[model samples]
Target chain A: MNISGKNSISGMLKTILQICFWGGIAFLILLPILLFAIGKHLNSFVYVLYPNGICFLIFVKQFIELFNLLKENNPFCNSTVKRLSIAGKAAGIISIILGAETIFNIIVIKDEITSIFILGFMCILFLGVSIALYILSELFKQAKEYKEENDLTV
Target chain B: MGIIVNLDVMLAKRKMSSQELAEKVGITPTNLSILKTNKAKAIRFSTLEKICEILECKPGDILDYIE
Candidate 1:
């Protein structure tokens, strides 16, 4: 449980940022496939693509914040970085839920059982990831407190 | 909540600057500042040991029980 202060926060931030970056790329790359499997074109929907794009952008911003902090080794930036990470995770979860809903609606209206099952599975996976992220946040907060006390004692 | 870092006193007794101590302890100056300012989340035993060695002091010299 005892980790170097520099390593612990940086390690967590790095992992979270990497997930966000890759997750964004995965969603963007799969957009066309998802739309095609749903048997719809983006041009047919007005606001469907934009929400996912916005969430990706937020995640990228957080990634940048984390990168800057890592480079500067700034302690003051840790809280802000953690906050932005939570915000990015929240946005990602919301966008995933919305995307699932849209896909589900399309599948039901089109009587497509396969797409419905796939989207439902994806929704479940997203829920799992969101829950894990929330738990990690709480754990990090506890670790932070524990580290504070240890630092004082030393 | 009960333990406080008496780093300021140790630094004064040793005539050491935070930056110097940070270098000796192998931590960033900002981390040292956090420790000195009572904002750090935790410290490693190795770092604490380094600080004590550099300051020519014991753990008790740098920490105190607060009422």
Candidate 2:
């Protein structure tokens, strides 16, 4: 199996990310209408939804960029590390947004405790993702340094 | 960064072109250019040995240290 190329695992992951990204946009676009159709006692979840969606889109975009680097077999570069750091920050923002939304749901919505529990779980999940992304960024930084040194050893 | 590559000086003294040296050293011209421009982080002993052998000079002749 080729690791880096037009036809590779990273390429597959990139395609999946693109699907998730565009699918997310479509879902965001249709969400208000869907909520309207449901006609529940929900008060202005749009604010929370949009911010979280945008953060998720940004996070996915960063991964797409990182996968582009992987496709080029140039993953061990400064830009990859920078992209990972940005993705990590985006993930952190997502976690914060989810945390706030969870609190808001508990205070204002006050209907489904199960949904709130899910939101809290999601908040913790994104926070873990954020920390994992930061660790990956650090790993990439070290790998980039080592690659530079090795490339220069001629 | 304090270490300087004196490849040009040795190449000039030997009356050899970088392309010729790169060809004889079995390395790419881009790698040779990297070393020449001092953008290289380190030199492998094997590559240094090849360069020294090709140029008929010591490693010290191609590398210099500056404060």
Candidate 3:
């Protein structure tokens, strides 16, 4: 009964993430078609969207797993650690893609210097998040070991 | 494997059921099972004291060391 509110909130978050995951998939599928409908050419700028979309989906997946762990009241288990690690890798991949995209944009579009700077900043920011998540995953792993030892102590 | 619990041997010598000992020790049957099966990571001093008191044995009687 005490955890009912927490479970409800986790359920709500899972639902939202599920919606985002599917919506992102649909958007990725429709993006090129919509661009073509507007008579716009698909360029290197458009190529970057594919990896970004995939990274967003991966993040949704990571959050869904996290919400499931919260719902089960086992947020410090091995699965949670694995999910965090996966999310960290996903963010790292996204950061790499953003770095490449920034370089491509700088060469292809000379007038978008400010936008390119913002993209480079995002790359650095995501790299930091990835490292932080990796460290947090290691901490969770130690916590899980401690919890198991405590559970068995009695 | 340095510390081994001889809980099963003690239980058998005392002619007591695991459920009975569990109830007396105020621990769940599952936890007693963990101890008996040597699946527990560590034993608490309080639990060791309770088991010793209930079984009328020293901690040494219920634990052994192996090389």
Best by TM-score: 3
lDDT of 1 by residue, A1-154 (tens): 4222544565666677777777777777788889899898776332554565665556566656656654665533347438555754865565476566657467556646775666567566656656666676566667666655765543
| Alpha carbon deviation, residue B32, candidate 1 (Å) | 12
Candidate 1: what is its chain A TM-score?
Answer: 0.55
Model 2 chain A worst lDDT run, 10 consecutive residues? A2-11
Which residue runs does candidate 1 get wrong by more than 4 Å?
A1-46, A67-81, A84-88, A99-108, B1-67
The CAPRI class of candidate 2 is high
Instruction: Return the clash pairs for model 2, or none.
Output: none
On DockQ, the stronger of 1 and 3 is 3
In the range A7-118, model 2's lDDT, one tens digit per residue, is: 6576576678999999999999988788889995445667687888988999998888877777676788889889989999998998998898899889887859988999
Scoring model 2 with DockQ, what do you get? 0.83
Tens-digit lDDT track of model 1 for B1-67: 7767889998988788988888888888877888888766566889888888899889898878788
Model 2, B1-67: lDDT tens digits are 5989999999999999999999999999999999999898888899999999989999889888898
Candidate 3, lDDT over the whole model: 0.88
Residue A132, candidate 3: Cα error in Å is 2.1
Chain A superposition TM-score, candidate 2:
0.84
lDDT of 3 by residue, B42-67 (tens): 88899999999999999999999998
What is the per-residue lDDT of model 3 for residues A73-114, given as tens digits with 9 covering 90 to 100?
Answer: 778888999999999998999899998888877886764678
Against the reference, the lDDT scores of all candidates come to 0.68, 0.88, 0.88
